[model samples]
Target: MTFSWRRRRSGRGGDGKSEVFKGINQDMELTIPTHFRCPISLDLMKDPVTLSTGITYDRESIEKWIDAGNITCPVTNQVLRNFDQIPNHSIRKMIQDWCVENKSCGVERIPTPRIPITPYEVTDIRSRIVAAARVGDARKCQELVGKIKDLAKESERNRRCIVGNGIGSALADSFESFARFSVDAHVNLLKEILAAFTWTFPLDEEGISKLKSAVSLRCMVWFLKSENDLSSRQNAICVLKELISADQACVDGLMGIQDIEETLFHTVKVPICPKATKASLVIIYNMIKSSKEKSGEIALKFIRMGLIHLILEILVDGDKSVCEKALGVMDSICSLEEGRENAYENALTVPLLVKKILRVSDTATEFSISSLCKLCLGENESALVEAMQLGAFQKLLVVLQIGSGERTKEKVTELLKLMNLCRDKVDCVDASMGFKYIKRSN
Candidate 1:
């Protein structure tokens, strides 16, 4: 198959990284050499890399093939003994030279590609990390972890290779061992360790379990305090979210830490990054979800912390996804009497939820509807009357007409029934005898 490169001006992408091979000039016609083209993509190779089968292709093309579980070379049909793709530096140089020669033709030189960190190198780093941790060499451990963090930040491929080599678990183990001693002298080391752990997200089961340990929890809690830097606290909260989600037991020990509740509340009350804020919300939701026995007690605790008013403020102008997560927290909170009362008392709560019914995504709509049902169905006809006044009935009709999930539809139907029942009691009441007397005067 023949491939054509689209013409475009060279510039950086949204990530602020230089655009690769996007500077080809279509107006100035020039024939690209066959050897300079990737066999898989049939396009000019941007980062030509030779595989074990002695055939060259673009790094992206080959990586995609291997990631799709292909074991054989695409050109030779020979089984790949290893996944290594060595950079064809000579060919790359020749390509650049050709581009320089054709400068009059508007040919742009392909930038030199950074070699991806190999698994072998990552394994070597892991070994040294183990040795350093074993000998209680905090200084060496810090240097090694810094290197690992740099590699992880370099590229997605390097991060994958680092995680595949079990660097995350190794770092966690090292941190635990070192934490057994005084960590005051190694504050920077602890910060680096927590940040490194955050970079290796979607952790394996072993990594999750290791992070769930008391030592790891203590370390995370220490950074979460208001005294630490924002980045350190952000990393700690992120890792804590992963651990708590993986195991419910993690939440028990985490909640027991002194000032942890205030720390988490402060983290949520003040925005760090979207990611860390979302993590904080998830942690709060999970805490409520896991402690079914004490769910009401937990809900009351958060309500006392001003969670109800705080989330109402979020729902006002938060993005669709954040609104959805915030609504989920509200749903969990509204499961209890105190939570429902707090929500009913908040003037923004009912109206905001009604607006979200058919406006946001289905997940958000579901949570909104569920929370609304809980609030209005409680020991007050006022919530029901206020909901109808906010045009909730009209929105529910739209939801039913357009159709929603079974659970959402059911809640909508139930809420409609309740509102329909409340209409008689609400509408019959006289609005104002003074207005009627004024009509008589007119």
Candidate 2:
């Protein structure tokens, strides 16, 4: 295959420090080579990695070489980075040999090395940024910050090089490396970095602890206090979730803040991606559930601050997974009898619980319907009667008949039994109608 080259030169001095290089324009036409094709694959070099013997190159090795900036095949000394950049003589011979060796094989071209920056360089810069961040040296920190930002912008400009790059991982690693300095750095600068690459926090076990220790809750709360944009605030919540999971100390710190109730409510109310919302909910639920002191107070605060309504909204509108999670939260809140009774006395819990059940139409999943039924039954007998009066029995029966899955039918039967036990309190006609619907469906 043919290959081409473009050189980018940084306007800076010849210190090999030029940030720019002029390379081959991607639009230029080029001639193909023939003799350099692979014997087994009969294709141009792809992801060519140099073998341990230093003579043969394979696809995986080629990829590492490309990622590591060794673009030329050592044995052939052929430029393998771009198909069009290959010498025409080599291409012609490779094609002729391929045709002679395999009459049915079509010419396969290798992928071009699109990214200009090497992974090593990215790693180097990331290390320097972390080192600078460590000493709390303002000037070095600012310099590294500028470099990281420029690299990000450069990556954006070079689509070929930036695609599938490990930029996010590098950024998160750098942030964690600077954990010791996080408390000392300028909060505004930290906020800027947090805002710029908010989505880099990894959810896996390896990254969870590093993220928590590196970023303080104070810094996160600070950013949330200063920033009004929902997107940035959402990122803050994401980073916080990582920390909340890894460090109970961080969770306690967050809980001890002067106006944490407001902060928690604000975070729950913010419109965010579903994954982020789920993470936040898990973190909060775990924190509240595990706490020994004032746990009920925190639960009450969530309800008082209108977060319960938001949770219900998600339950009603979100997909099955989210609905299941919402149920878990409701279950947790109601597990504390005092909190559940208080919520009932305030007249907030029953209406929302009833709404969820009433919304369970024929389309509702059995798990969601069952969850709602379970919550209702856990409440006082008065609450169950009120829910039946709101036409929940009719909806439950519809779900039983038209719901798609086995779980749905199973829950439907369970709900029917529960409603029958409360038959004396429910409108007898509604109960009878439900019983007839069940009998007819069976």
Predicted candidate 2 versus true structure: per-residue lDDT over 1-442, tens digit per residue: 4444232333334564321122324344323343354433434443333334343343433444556777565567666645222223334444445434432232233334333455567667656665665665546655665665655565343323322344444444445544335534555556555654543433344344444552445556656555455555676777677666555666766776667667756666774577667767766676567552554677667766666567766765776556656656665665565545544564545555556553544333443454455555554677667657776677666665555577667656766777788887866435444455444335
- Candidate 1 local lDDT, residue 104: 65
lDDT per residue for candidate 1 within 1-442, as digits (tens), equals: 3334554454533542433344445454466678888889876677899999999998989999999999999999999999888999999998888778876656667878788898889989998998998898999999999898887777788998898878887887787777767667777887888888876766667767777787778888888884548888888888898777667789888766776767777888888988887888888887777554564566567888999898888888888878888999999888878788888888898999898887889898889999988887756778878888888877877788787898887788777767666766565333331212111212
Worst 10 residues of 2 by lDDT: 17-26
Assess each prediction's global lDDT (C-alpha) against the native.
0.80, 0.54
- The candidate that achieves the highest TM-score relative to the unseen native structure: 1
In candidate 2, how many Å is residue 341 off? Answer: 2.7
